[model samples]
Target: MSQSRRNFLKAMGAASLTAVGAKNAKATPKNVLSDDRFGVLVDTTVCIGCRQCEYACKVEHDLPAGNIDDYSDRSVFEHMRRPDHTALTVVNGYPSEKDKQQQVTVKVQCMHCDHPACVSACIVGAISKQENGAVIWDESRCIGCRYCMVACPFQIPAFEYHKAIEPKIMKCDLCYETRTSKGQPPACVEACPTEALIFGKRYELIQIAHERIRKNPDRYYDHVFGEHEVGGTSWLYLGSQDFSKLGFPDLGTKPAPGATEPIQHAIFKFFVPPVALYALLGGIMWLGKQNREEEE
Candidate 1:
């Protein structure tokens, strides 16, 4: 209320505004910059669950001969299974009443979600979303905390518990080392003699999926899983029955579990806070120096 008090408050307010303005001057980087590379699109309508793909994955990866249940031999078919620490990919049998014996075999592995949560979960930057959209993990950088497994909405990433010596995060890296990096198709797609698993550009795969549904409406489900669901996966699926009945949950068009980076980006206007802090300190120190000079 007094003149001196009013002037002091006004100066403080003006200083804050200047700092805020300075902070806002920098541009923020966008998090959703997608890559042009493509990936395998599993057309579930065609997979027969021959286990050949699983076999190929085993030989290629070169693990112990056979798993206790299946991973030892990669017999994902021996039991209805999901991809785990040992098995990178598993073909599960889907029995639909609409097309009985359609016996749709869906190959379960990393969907390689476009906006991946695994990448965000890792404190060491061990998990990365590849250019082709395959979400891969680097063991060298991993701490084996298993947060990635927890962060994945699909529960795809698995950890290697077999080794008490030095276990690590274990899951499909989209066969990056063995095939994709060489400009060749993945083992699963290659092993499918029936052309069930098709690997190619993501957009092209969606077109192929729609084509199959249109050709035989009675044989295939009208919807294509992973095309838009969970912000779209590099790998996709099709089936005679609804995806949910076959264990695929009802997911939204939004990016799957590990894709919440946009939310982070919005909150962390990276340079803004630092710049503002600097401006405030600069003004404070400048004022202190001015006061000392006046005293002198």
Candidate 2:
């Protein structure tokens, strides 16, 4: 083989080794969720589809503060909407069998998982789970790769696709900087007229949720939506109908990252896969060189 071919082969081998080393590297210390962590209980049955929470979230986040009256427009409920870069939280209306004419509005935002997959997927340490149970993203540290979007089970993280430069990963932080850190309720909870959203310590909230379910057995589903989903989320939900009707995924009691992490770690640590990948690429390059030489 020519000297250039030898050098190319050596480069590919080195790259394969480097890739394996990077993938097999030790992860950062896991951020454990405290029992005293703050959380919110969203009682969907009581929610009037007012969209006051959406307006409150926007105002608190310093996003577009449109006329508050405009939020009352129920036409927006025609389609299911996800939290985008422009809006951190959105209240979606789901049909209720109990109420034929009216739909139950459920607020959608970051679940702030106890074992956050976004934190694990973020190679740049952009995302973090706060002790208060808020999952926040640091724009300065974010590489805008959108891995967090893929990692999040709820698909909470949204990228700023419109911005040409320095776009941000946007999601709910549970108003940690504005209110939760100061022991005040989030803007949505505070602004809720119907007391649909209750904020307190996560353990306390879970107890309250169970009590409510027990008291009004006919009013709510027996299970709290986030209590054990994805190893428990900071935000819990209660609805009369099944959560699947409210667009919530049936994620089961197991944590999302638990099933995937081991497989991902082994793929890189074993080295066989990366070596084979590089070998295939190198072979293709060699074939291209041969074809070019024949033409010459």
Candidate 3:
């Protein structure tokens, strides 16, 4: 690894550790800072591949509809399309039966990692992990560099490619401003006809997920997607077959993107390193100036 990357990782030590501290500090801040608001829990095994949620997202956000007229069509899906500017959420088809082409689809959107890479990669701090579980970006603060796009491990955090002015990071915010703030679910979850997507407290949802698994372990995978991956996630997944089979990469338990900041903070931000560095530089400059004056 390069020196900068190595230095960054060394500085990020404590924040990356899984070991409990003297006490487990509260994680209820925001998606980036901590888990503040509640989040959605998606059980892929139950998802019916209905795109009502996608249509709802476009309508809620006032985005122009691009490709499909029929929400249920599986044709365009032969190609993998992720969440993007026009489409805040895209359901990808995962072929299950090798011979029969029995497919299962998982809805892709911001996983809303507890340590969101989008929040850290953003230089202007335009994007913030809200006190709620949502990661929100203020367009006014955005310079449109698209670092958030590059930092996301899930490859989420889409940008407004069409807008010439006041463009911003465009992705799911769990409808924090509209639905979640009002104590209602997001447009996508609301539009799901089947109980495919459920919204509630993260703790409660974990319980519900476990119950579903215990009832029918044979029907669902034994693993929970977002629980401990890179610290935790507001959104989670439960699938019947292997997650990889459904376009889900086996990420093992690493925190998702934007995770480095907290790690950065825990190690480097504690001692006021900036102040120390400034002091050191000031001392050096002063010494050099004094030496030059003596020579003159």
Candidate 4:
């Protein structure tokens, strides 16, 4: 082959490879972050049903600071309560099978998932996963679509339904702007007297969870709740019994994004191939016309 022809073919091959690489890259789902992101480890056995974490979360968020003493009432645990606009976090009591009189308390809030479904589902880009492992919402960017609430596997996001105007989505932000950004632990973690909640780097917390489980196999179940659920979350949990009994959903290790991305990609790919093919043909036709014009 002529040297020029060989060079032309090589250039075309490189361009085709680059195009394929870009397509494959876009098709792949977002990967898990391996960086030094913050996380929390919750040992359910250590939680003493004090509800101090709930009170601290309220105070930190500047919510109704009703007498802190009122939070001591265990009657609230009679029925399940979730995090709402007024409260960013809630501590719930589950009847302990070992002791019928005693109830195990577990704090509920946004899990700050490594691959957050809320971030993926937000049509207006209202929700985002922070570098420090916080899944946060921007009210200014929100159009009140409420798609995020439907998307979350944990059902963490709560909407301000009472407000007639300018309602905002509410959820735990991992205290990113208030404490975590300033190198401080979350208010709830700080308030836990029993050290039930351990706040640190995600990887470090996972190691600690494993160590605790290994040291006292009888005390805790072998599984670390957030290590692989929905492609891993920043909030880790250790339970003496099955997590499902503690009100945690039994989500398999498969990432939630896997379900949504394929449909979305299929729609995009359906349109993209035709558009790209047209552009390529148009370019070839244009080149041919230019050559003819040159000869004329």
Stretches of model 1 off by over 4 angstroms after superposition: 1-35, 65-79, 257-296
- Residue-level lDDT for 157 in candidate 4: 92
Q: What is the C-alpha local distance difference test score of candidate 3? A: 0.79
Error of 4 at 109 (Å): 0.5
The CA lDDT of each predicted structure is 0.75, 0.91, 0.79, 0.89
**Best first by TM-score, ranked:** 2, 4, 3, 1
lDDT of 2 at 184: 94
Best-performing candidate as measured by lDDT: 2
Off by over 4 Å in 3: 1-36, 66-69, 97-101, 257-296
* lDDT (Cα, 0-100) at 234 in candidate 3: 85
lDDT of 2 by residue, 112-189 (tens): 998889988887889988888898999889988888899999999998899999998999999989899898999999
Backbone clashes in model 4, listed as residue pairs: none
Clashing pairs in 2: none
| Tens digits of per-residue lDDT for model 3, 1-296 | 45797788876786666445533575443333432457788988778787878988998888875554587787756888898887889888777643255677789998887877777788788887766678887878888899889887788888777878777688888898998877789998888888799998777788888899999988888877788776678898888876777787666676664356666676666577888899999999999999999999
For lDDT, candidate 1 versus 2, the one ahead is: 2
Query: What TM-score does each of the candidates earn?
Result: 0.72, 0.81, 0.75, 0.80
> In candidate 1, which residue pairs get closer than 3 Å at backbone N, Cα or C atoms, i.e. clash?
66-72, 66-73, 67-71, 67-72, 67-73, 115-259, 116-258, 117-258, 230-256, 231-254
Kindly report which residue stretches of model 2 are placed more than 4 angstroms away from their true locations once superposed.
Answer: 1-31, 267-296
What is the C-alpha lDDT profile of model 1 across 6-116, one tens digit per residue? 899999999999999887886343333344566676767667667677767776777543642342343444467878766677778767676564566678888887877
Error of 3 at 133 (Å): 0.7
